[model samples]
Target: MPLPLYLLAVAVFAMGTSEFMLAGLLPDIASDLDVSVGTAGMLTSAFAIGMIVGAPLVAALARNWPRRSSLLGFTLAFAAAHAVGSSTTSFPLLFATRVVAALANAGFLAVALTAAAALVAPDKKGRALAVLLSGTTVATIAGVPGGSALGALLGWRAAFWAVAALCLPTALGILKGIPAGRAREQTIGGAALRAELAQLAMPRLILVMLLGALVNAATFAGLTFLAPVVTGTAGLSELWVSVALVLFGIGSFVGATIAGRLSDRNPGAVIAVGGPLLLIGWPALAVLADEPVALLLLVFVQGALSFALGSTLITRVLYEAAGASTMAGSYATAALNVGAAVGPLIAAAALNTGAGSLGPVWSSGFLIAIALLIAFPFRAMIRADSNTEVLQ
Candidate 1:
């Protein structure tokens, strides 16, 4: 809702694009560096690993620092990393830069999530988070594609340079827009660190985090291999893969936007209704993989349901971790990345079993089914406010 929130979203767009655009640039990077495409793919894994480790580490280190300064520092660091990465001829150097960039990106996102929630009223926290996360969805729709096109027109290095250049204005905007002294003044010392760490023992908090991770894992299990599903199974041409991706991205954007408004009022209802639809959509997609038209439509529908449920779970994390520590945002970020790291691995295992494109879809279905079971008994707990008595 606030201008500062939008500015954070802009920063997110730049970082998000850098995170995902590598998918298109991997071939170029691999060929230029004399590495195989599979090796180049590790760059994505490196980023994911960095994000998982960095969110909590960076957030803890900067817990005493002002939010505005932390954001600006991370943004600039990310830009610098990209600049170095683009210029590097050495694969090892490029890989190191990817790790560094991911660290900066994770730090920025962790702080940005907390800052965005702080920028709004308690009741508006969900909407604020939605607005902040919409940047990533929009990145999926526009920024990633734009980066790919830039890579195609110029060179892969050009796309990196472009991301670096975009960050300068984002840094300037953060400095201009975010107010000073907005850091976690309440958690400035050793006691605060202990308090943050102690959150790991809270059953309710852990449950929410687990749910967030599981839902995200399920979403990615299918999402990562969508190209094969669109082309190999659906009998579509290569061009249709891009169309399928765009349709999914559009659905994600819409779902997240709507879920933000709804989750604030009734997160339980949002999850309860969306979860079943998501569970069913995965299997339905797998069953209809041969039907090009159905596959395309289901891709869109599945994206909507996946993000709708995923965003609601993330919003729930905010509330569940309320008043615990500023590290709450770090917890959410880490959970999501954990899922991002694990989902594709599970899907890969399924694929190894000769399941073809359908492996990922079934894998997704299995994961969501488990998520629903975990959340079912906890529905009352999820719906209850953090300050209220814990539902048994």
Candidate 2:
């Protein structure tokens, strides 16, 4: 609802594009960098590792800074990292740049969400967060496909350059448009913060984080290799792969929107439905690899289910970590990134085994199925949020 939320969305769009565009660019990167495709996939893992570590680390460093300053600082660093990535010709240099970019991305995401929440009324907090997060979904719709097309027409480096250029405007928007709001009060600190964080070790909280990680890992395993999978399985032309990406983005948008709407009233239902749907979608895509129409449709379904699970999973984590809500979101963010990093690593390993393109897809489906089973035993614990202690 606030202009700040929209600005946050823009920041997220730039980050999301940089985060995901690599999937589409992997084929090009591998060839140009003189590495195998499997090796090039480490780019995604490197980015994820950055996020996994950066969210809390950056949040801590900027904990006392003005919200707008933190957001702008992180965004500028993000843009600069992309610029460095665009110029680098070496694989190790490129990998290092991705890690730098991801750290900026993670800091921006953590602060942007906090800033967005600060801008809204208590009743509208969820809606505000949805608006901020929609940037990533919108990135899938526009940035990812657009980056792929640009990479196809120009070069993969061009995609990074474009992302770098896009970030400047977002940084400017944060500076000139969003107000420099005072920091929210730190009601809990020292021993209190330690106690809150310690609750993260509870079985229920651990299970939820594990579930989130597994879902992300499953989704990204196939996603990181989507270019090869579709091209190999459905015999798609380069142009058609972009088209499929658009479809996948559309599904992600729809799924995230639907999940956001249902999150408050029926989080359980969202999980029950989305989890199984993802499990079904992943394997169906693998088994029906030869069917072009099915390939297209399944990608959409997989995208939807993946985000649906993501939305619901975050909600569950917040509930479980009611005593440390802010840190909970950051921790959940890290967990998701952990999955993002590990999933691709596993998929790359499979690809190197000569398991072919379908191997990652099927393997991801199995992981999703395991996540669903894990969810059931923890259902009551996840639902017990109202009884939990508040932070401070």
Query: Which number leads on lDDT?
Result: 2
Superposed by TM-score, candidate 2 places the C-alpha of residue 170 at a distance from the truth, in angstroms, of 1.6
* Model 1, CA-based lDDT: 0.79
Model number with the top TM-score:
2
TM-score of each: 0.82, 0.92
**C-alpha lDDT of candidate 2 relative to the true structure:** 0.82
Error of 1 at 246 (Å): 2.1
**Candidate 2, position 177, lDDT:** 64
- Tens-place lDDT per residue, model 2, 1-392, is 86757877887988898888887889999999899988999999999999999976765555556788888888888888888888888999999988999898888876777777778888787788878887888899989999999998999989999998888777777877666874455644667667767877878778878988999999789888999977787898877778878988998888888887887566778887778778888888988888999999989988888988886777677777777755776787888899999999889888856558887888798789888788887776555344554221
Q: What clash count does candidate 2 reach?
A: 0
